[model samples]
Target chain A: MYVAAKGGEKAIRNAHALLAKRRRGNKNLPSISLAQIAQQLTLAVDRVMAEGSLYDVELAALAVKQARGDLIEAIFLIRAFRTTLPRFGYAQALDTSEMLVRRRVSATYKDLPGGQLLGPTFDYTHRLLDTSLGVADEAGEVDDEARQADPADAAPVAMPRVTDLLGQEGLIEAAPADEGAEPFDITRAPVSFPVDRSTRLQTLARGDEGYLLALGYSTQRGYARSHPFVGEIRFGDVEVIFEAPELGFELSLGTVQVTECQSVNQFKGSATTPPQFTRGYGLVFGQCERKALSMALVERALRWKELGEEPGAPAQDEEFVLSHCDNVQATGFVEHLKLPHYVDFQAELDLVRRMRAEQAAERPADGIKEAAE
Target chain B: MALMARAEAGELEAVLAGFAPLPAASDLKPPEVGLVMLRGRTGGDGAPFNLGEATVSRAAVRLEGGASGFAYRLGRDVKAARAAAILDALWQDEARRAEVDAALAPVRARLAAEAAQVRAETAATKVDFFTLVRGED
Candidate 1:
């Protein structure tokens, strides 16, 4: 006597309890620690940070452990936790030109300033999995190369931006001069249509990496057209400067590592702006070179209107791009179907059942009689 | 103010290294750690992306005289943060300004010493690489 009409509250509670128990998993097996997740599953933590839209490593690692390494679930958890916290203030835009670069390479130029130091990249590594990674050996763990400052090339206070060089040669349109206008804070308010440039960038930065990557890939398939070259990509630490109201001065809070990418795209002359190379840009926290590059491509793709060109591609659609970019939002709505939908289901069920009965009563022997006629 | 917090943050542990005179505070916000998404832009004005999360602790307090102060510091030091909020509130008062400065003197001395030590180490390792004059020149 299974009643489809009734709820599964008891079962649901039990399932949740079971989930908690299994998340901790077998007692005999060693339990994974938060620090280990932070250390070993660094990239996974990075994803959670990106999609979760919050940046605490410990908490993101904890979410990873808590969600049993389901990255989307962990991202959801971080987002849920993030909503409860208070925002202090916005940080000043970091100067990536002065980054203490750990890894820097330019596809456009070979012998650029700071030369190419390909620090800690997967580009050179073989794809084969090493079984030795399963075994934990503290001594065998690879350490990050200690950065040496060679006097032959001291890092310039301001590295010559590749785009700036193009601008100087009159090969590209000059960048918009700084108006010191504050960008809209999307976190504090609902995202409005025709959002400011900063708000748009903010949305794309934390957009689902996979989704953005696919969209960026689509551009290469001629969904959108852009002749893009990797002007520069850099990874490194940069100091954070915050202006304190109490002291009436600014101070360096500390440093955080970042990854940045710039894509130079071919452009023809528009009505107002001259024919110069357009720029696509991406910046992210941590070593996310691929994500940054994808973001840059997609960002440029979205900039068709600003460049006075028509935005006809799917990647170019602002509403479509922004709304579905957040992984947490996508997961929540889709996966909420797992929750009890008995009420809605019953409503549809009743309508179907009544319609079937009415049709049976109106017809003679069957639908066969009507068909024969 | 972020600058005040940075200036006081290093000294926070040291300033309250001893006893702190607690100003009357109703915690508008109690000491709590929250995740702040750090964003960076390519070439300063380029596209922005999340760098990662830093653990930040913050506290806000209003003194008896009604000056309100707030502090945000790196990491999960609750007591230090609470003390900083009170110091911020106290330092605002003309009468308490001198007292707050006196209390923070040790923190300043220690930080200055640390900076000097770093400078010395950096100078010790300094190497000047000069291009060799070409034989043609």
Candidate 2:
């Protein structure tokens, strides 16, 4: 049974007012602009974009600012905003092979085609805080001339994928042929069990980074261990193409930066198939390297049944992972505890009180007898 | 359309403003902001999968002279989307086509320069690994 409880509108309104003031901080300090967050706090923006499942840097930055830097809140804000906009249609599948390579590396190979480019990464940086960053930028500071490259030194336009090299020697399993059929849309339909690879990939792609990281770590700690090597990880921009009904031909819809990881896992030969290296793939919006790698590991671990491997780990259970992966859904259920539950609590209280009264009536003199004893 | 889509936030709008008395075009489809679900292949070459969605604004316009043009671009710049759609309609006419190209030339150049700059910076980081010779060798 449910009952209505009201009369907090004024308090709610004032709380919102207080929140706005708190979000602003000191009045003397200049407020952070959306541009600043979009450019400097780019990774934060990227995270909200990835998990929110909506790619718009400006909006993500806005959400970050509005949420007072609370990433989960920011993601919630982005998701709420997503419901207002209508879906135009699906775009053509992205071709990562045509990416304008910014950073490309392979852990399994020392030397690969097109060579490795480090780009701008914190991988080699010392963890010590740089006091220099605390100070405002000095105007007109120039970049090192020596760091600039000659046009002739540029990498080849298209770097061959690391998997392809292994594939040529029949060491790695070949990719299934492209059927050109439309993939399942998770956003449109409710997720059911026995989902296809497409649906699983979509869920993982939009899943929370921290959750995926923990699950991936579990796999590495010998829970359904699949000896995995990062075949390739690349981050860069790729053009998005959409086919509009009004426009008969496909049209380019600008570009988006994405990080992609391909994990090569060992698969012992099944009774019917030969022994070969299997694969796990991850692709996410913007330069989210860690998240992409984690997604790949978890994705591979989840494929145990398909690969004929014994499955017992938490990550291998698709239902658990998919159901709990979405932070928006997870936070909603967890946070709803804060809302008024007076009726439900009253019912429980009544039940408990009645049971206590009955117990006292049944043994009215037991308390005095126990005390005397 | 590609050049316009790649143009800076206000670049398209500024170019459109230059042609003060714009060629009157009817809205075949008014500018509307929406999402476009982006798809990706499982293994980069195999079965398809949904990656995510991107914000897109699209508009369709028909010029007075009976030419129709449409545009779809990333982000929520409604005015820029409409401006690109108008330019597309104008570009269908042979005489107005050159005018459109001349206006968008700077954007094309800027995009090219930006691409070149990234390519150069990336090139500088390209590693050439060499194995050391063992003393026995």
Question: Which candidate tops lDDT?
Answer: 2
Candidate 2: list runs displaced more than 4 Å. Answer: A1-4, A137-144, A359-373, B17-20, B129-137
Sum up the clashes in candidate 2: 0
lDDT of each: 0.71, 0.89
**After best superposition, candidate 1 residue B130: deviation in angstroms?**
25
Best by TM-score: 2
DockQ of each: 0.16, 0.76
Please give, for residues B1-137, the per-residue lDDT of candidate 2 as tens digits.
88988887689888888776876888987789999999888888888899999999988888786588788889999878888888888788787889989999999999887888888888898877677888985
Measured on C-alpha atoms, candidate 2 has an lDDT of: 0.89
Q: Please, what are the lDDT tens digits per residue for candidate 1 over residues A1-373? A: 1124556789989999999999988989999998999988888887787777665677889999999999989988988887776655566678887776666777887655545556556876798877776676553553322333443344243566677677778887655555666556667679879775667778887788899999999887887778789888887767776554545666555566677888889888777767778888877767778888988888888878877766688988888998999898898888877766777888889999999989888875878776888
**In model 1 chain A, which range of ten residues has the least summed lDDT?**
A143-152
RMSD of each: 7.1, 2.5
Which candidate should be chosen as best, given DockQ against the real structure?
A: 2
Question: What TM-score, over all chains together, does every model reach?
Answer: 0.77, 0.94
Native contacts retained per candidate?
0.17, 0.86
